[model samples]
Target: MACNKSFSSNYFLLTPEEVGFFDLIHILFSTTKFEEGIKFLDMSKFVSKPLSELGSGIEVALNLIPSNRNVFVFMLNFLRGRAVKPDKTSATFLSFIGLIDKRVELDGSIKHGDANYHAALSAMASKASYENSACIETIVKNHWKMKFLGFYDFWNDYQGKATTQAFLLRDKTCDQDTIVVAFRGTEPFDADAWCTDFDFSWYELYGAGKIHGGFMKALGLHKNDGWPKEEVKQDGKPPRPRAYYAIRDMLNKLLRQNDESRYIVTGHSFGGALAILFPAILAMHDEAWLLERLQGVYTFGQPRVGDEKFGEFMEKQLKEHRVPYFRIVYGNDMVPRLPFDDNALMYKHFGTCLYYNRHYEVKVVEEEPYRNYFSSLGAIPKMINAFWELIRSFTISYAKGPGYKEGWLLRIFRIIGLVIPGAPAHSTQDYVNATRLGSSDVFVPPKDI
Candidate 1:
């Protein structure tokens, strides 16, 4: 689990493949040979027994999910494939890509300066990112009336495969053409993508603070070489094109061609993590030119990405650059309230948190209520809320019109949420609904900061 020292002098790395059940149990009794499963550059500064036990237990439980997910997805697809045409696009465990809403057109009435317009557009783009290239291209060009720049599957050095996915599109308005980059989130059955969420390995940079190792890797963190200012090329081409370098180059060319054009970064769930992290890297590399043109960043159900120090660094950078970051959390969506903001993993979220309830009422808070999902006091209320959400699934269209209708696939997930409340709340449908139905006043920046 040893990483390149030049990037992070202090790091706690985990190689799940190297872990055994007995080794995990041993962590509860003793610290000896813990390095056999977990790697540390220098953990002695504050390595506690509770932290070790918690880390081991977390790895074991979360690892089971991805292992079981693979089989479940295979069985699901196999059964569905018999009755219908084989899905060419990425399909989640419960939902078919084709069956979900394909509407990409924005609201004709909602204009610029209103956050609803951009939020709705970005949410749709985020959902589109989950589909295949042809599907994404079709929606962007034919439905949204926008230009589809490109779609990519970028290389992740840790996964030893292209694990990250994103797309670029250009929207021409009356005043200026805006470039949008949408990063895809974790798919229900994609084990590799889920691993990115579950893997809690961390790296502590000199001034930037500790960051999630999985995300950095997904965002083109090279194996031996860290975030080099320039894209590293092998022979004539990159060994495999990485996301940060490739997108940075694309933006540089696209932005220069139109001086009036500015760009925005956006995503949902795991994609949201990448969305915010992308700007952090730009600031880290001192890419003032790119930062100046960065209009905003919008994320839905994004997880906590870094330690408090990292949060401070990003807040300062964003404030200095005058870039607004809106982190939208819908209802009890559990993704926004993790990896537990505790001593074991010191991750903390920064910036405006636009938290929405079942009615799509937004509350702008520094942090979402119940900062951790595993709260005993919030359990009963969350379940009651989940019950209401399930009922609303049948009645929302009637209340909010046909456009707000919930699909059968999503309804099934809502039923599952009765037992596990926040799981279903994390869907893109609710986030989209929140943008359209919720108040735009939540987008107004607070002066106190």
Candidate 2:
């Protein structure tokens, strides 16, 4: 009933054919004819098809079916089939329907003013520190109704030495189920994490601007997955970055296991950068359902990863899919501003920024033409500042490195009251603290910084 009201309000946004397709999906699901639904979709039509073509097909489907409340109700039942536990195929069909529902809501003109969404996201970001399995289990079991499905500890190295982690969570109690893949941020005093941060060489991606070579390699994308030569070359493109490939594999496996669940990808700092990247790569997949199921990406203090070209490409892709990327910034967190914004260097940030200033107030920055002021500075001054920042980053990295005798870096900072302006503003705790202050304390950004 609520969805119907929402859909009715935004009916203008939906073409006749889209409405028809929604009706068709609802009928097929209500009658338990999922196989026919899949056949009607015709996966071949999606592969290699651009968004316009895919959209056209949806239009045709809508034209053929009668749009009504039954369609919406059936679609909701399919998405919230918590009691049914449908087979994988049925699940996939239902998930596709669920994705369509989400896309409709997201693309609609209604304002998403729910504070609970932001609060829940902040809570998730706060959980980034639970790297140990037991701690993760405790948090999931005690704090929310969600179940801890599993944790993935992946290596950026080929030999499986240096590792980064992500965990999966599922909530089945709600009307619409959800699956979250949350990546952990840099450990307070771990050298390996710092090493991953420092290794920022630019690496070229096919059809996208150059990304941080270190992060790319750290995700193990350059390495082969032992697929047969022909299988590996099936896409006719060069090998995808190892991290992207690995994440895709894991996500595909999870989706199969939990077919009706919507996905939310998130992380903090280094992990936040990966969260932004994971969805960008996922958008390239031939499976239309995968992109549809993506709910949102929320990151805290993510660094600039690619150049302007990459940013442009991602902005277009994400906008087309009606996906929202919230890059939450706390104070003057330096990570969001780095790898240097120099156009010549090719590093840029994608998505709308929700900036929280020192007073823990918030403001939303829509995407615009970005100019890297650092590159615009006087030659001598720019060089001096760059050199100084480089040294400072290294020193901070080493202090946070595994070799540091300190138990944890954040604890040390708290004890000493050591608060620097930039990177220190980059912590997940700071983000959580700011968000806890609530929307009533929201701050508008001053016209002049």
Alpha-carbon RMSD to native, per candidate: 8.3, 23.4
For candidate 1, which ten residues in a row score worst on lDDT?
Answer: 90-99
lDDT of 2 at 131: 39
**Candidate 2 residues 1-449, lDDT tens each?**
01121211111111112233454334322423122112112222233235435544543343222222256654665578622332322212212112111110111111124443533443353343333565455556655545877766675533245466777777565365667778777654444565456544454455666566446545554344321212244257664334456556666777777667678788778888788877766654444566777777777777787777678878887777766677777655667766655433346787677777554557777531223323233335434433443343335436433221222334433333232335445555456544544352232222321
What TM-score fits each model? 0.84, 0.58
Q: Taking the tens digit of each residue's C-alpha lDDT, what string does model 1 give over 1-449? A: 55464777677676654545454334323424223138322221234344545544543343332334555764575577632223344222112332444345566667776757678889888888887788788778887889999999999987778889999999888887889999999876566677688666778877999898889989998777788898767568756889998999899999999889999999999999999999999998999999989988999999999999999999999999899899999999999988878666677999889999999999989999888887889999999999999999999989988777887767888999999989999988888888888998877656743
**lDDT of candidate 1?**
0.80
Clashing pairs in 1: none
- Name the top TM-score candidate: 1
- lDDT for model 2: 0.51
